[model samples]
Target: MSWRTPADALRNELIELFLNHPTESLSGETISEHFHISRTAIWKHLEHLESLGFVFDAAPRRGYRLLSTPDILFEPLLQPHLSTHSLGRSVLYRPVIDSTNRWAMELAEHGAPHGTVASAKEQSAGKGRRGRMWASPEGGLWMTLVLTKPIPLSRAGELTLLAGVAAAQSLRTLTGLDIRIKWPNDLLLNGRKLCGILAEIRAEAETVHTAVLGIGLNLTVAREDVPALLQETMISLSPSTSSPWTKARVAGAILSALEPLYDSLCQDAAGFSGVRSEWIALCAHMQRTITVRLGEQVVTGTCVDIDERGTLTIEVEGKRVQVPSGEIVRTEVW
Candidate 1:
């Protein structure tokens, strides 16, 4: 359940107008007239935009000048820039929620289409792989993309790798961090978690149903705010960058950058040429000696390679041992 303020709509309309007329300053009075609203209504809209971190200049004669837009999220503000026709045809944004993935799953059960997206500012009960809690704070990007592709059930596992590549590309673009992807969707930066992806599905009989791609990227929790051990355990966009990263910029970069990769994966299955190759390129410890931890059982082997199914292959003794997404995790982190 999400609600959008009237101010949100007005703000988006103004953003569309401004982006359309890039060089010209959009006057507040002109905006109101264009939207068939009042001057005071325009003021309220501008105030709301400011609250969302957009910067604008206002003068008595000129009305309002769109100077620079901040990186805070306003779904309507991001709607136009979503870029994908089928993917983001539907999107829901919530300022606070328990889990965007859970919400998206519920929507899927009710027959949401492919590429329907749900995002939240806070997740009180965010869950990572193996039921570990993901402490989702307000200033981070918490999103779930509900996907229903035509691929066979066996091919579904590729989404995890797809997500990792997308996230890595976005981080590289935004903060210029030399972020890497560990096997099975753990995003690593200097060997610390910068982002994580949890892929889930709901099926009815043998027919494939839905995939909830839950993604969480740590953005702005300073060290002092985090619990002592977690402060050392987790890393955010704040640590690697010289300055702070706003939610909007990070979110936009992720969607804009990743949408194409996702498009490619959906279009070309055998030719996962870029996605597979780039994922391997971003992995810090690819083909290196490392131990794969699968529950109580631990397997020590040389990291040989990753297969097309996104399985990590370990060279054990004389044979190659393959660990699937749901089974193994990297135990060692630097």
Candidate 2:
């Protein structure tokens, strides 16, 4: 809902009252006197809330009781649960957009502050690494976080890796699933792709002024809804777990998990060593044999370590090779 007018603000206030007393019935006269609006205005506001997927039970003497709220990623629904000082404190939400990354970049160009979050319910042109299109359906979390810090361009790769680690850690803790981070920018659940991270930065003179970290997580997408090519590889979260994780909850958890790590890296780039250790512990390819395709070269080796710079180390034919950037074509245990 566009909160540009006083009526919208009053409507939000009314919803908050119902949310605060979910089990108890609130009389319309009480709400009307509380908000200084007429009982007729209360009915009108409830209708507007109903259109937004809020279920209210109204009776003769007993007023209105909220039964359920929509799981959409609206600012009102998400703002109450956020505990971070920076990230997600100011949220801009859209029902449909071309890409959250694009929107975030635009905001950054206009001097949006650090830790501002832009999210969309559906993305028409969601981005993936290497200029690929990410399928951002309705039942997924598509958001971008804007970082307006002066991070050196050389160490920009750490953001994506740390983001993967944050997602894996938060999802595992929230859902009780074994979420693993594939080196570089992928999250895997049960050996299948569950989420992807794409980080874009605007840099000049070897320093980045603005970087947008875009994360796409499939939460409740169905199998058939997935593209045919990705059907065998991609997976969603809700179907695999018994917990009822709303999009707001997942989004809040990820931002909360990432804020401290991001702040540490921003304060001291050398602190990446500690974050690197955390990442390696969660790395899905560590100590496993994998084949990575770097342009024209395909290197198959056993993954050994990931350095502070977010480069992968592989043991190939008794020699250690550093893979600065590449895609893992295949993975095998032992």
Q: Write the per-residue lDDT of candidate 2 for residues 1-334, one digit (tens) a residue.
A: 2213466557657777887787999999999899888999889989977876889999999988999888877666777767788888656666789999999998777766788888888899899999999998888999999998777778788889878878889998899888898878999988888999999999999888889999999998887887899988889997899777898889999999888878777776454566777788888889999999999999999999988888899999999999999999899841
TM-score of each: 0.78, 0.85
lDDT of 1 by residue, 299-323 (tens): 8777778878778888899898888
* Predictions: Cα RMSD each: 3.9, 3.4
- Distance from true position, residue 309, model 2, in Å? 0.6
Q: Clashes in model 1: which pairs?
A: none
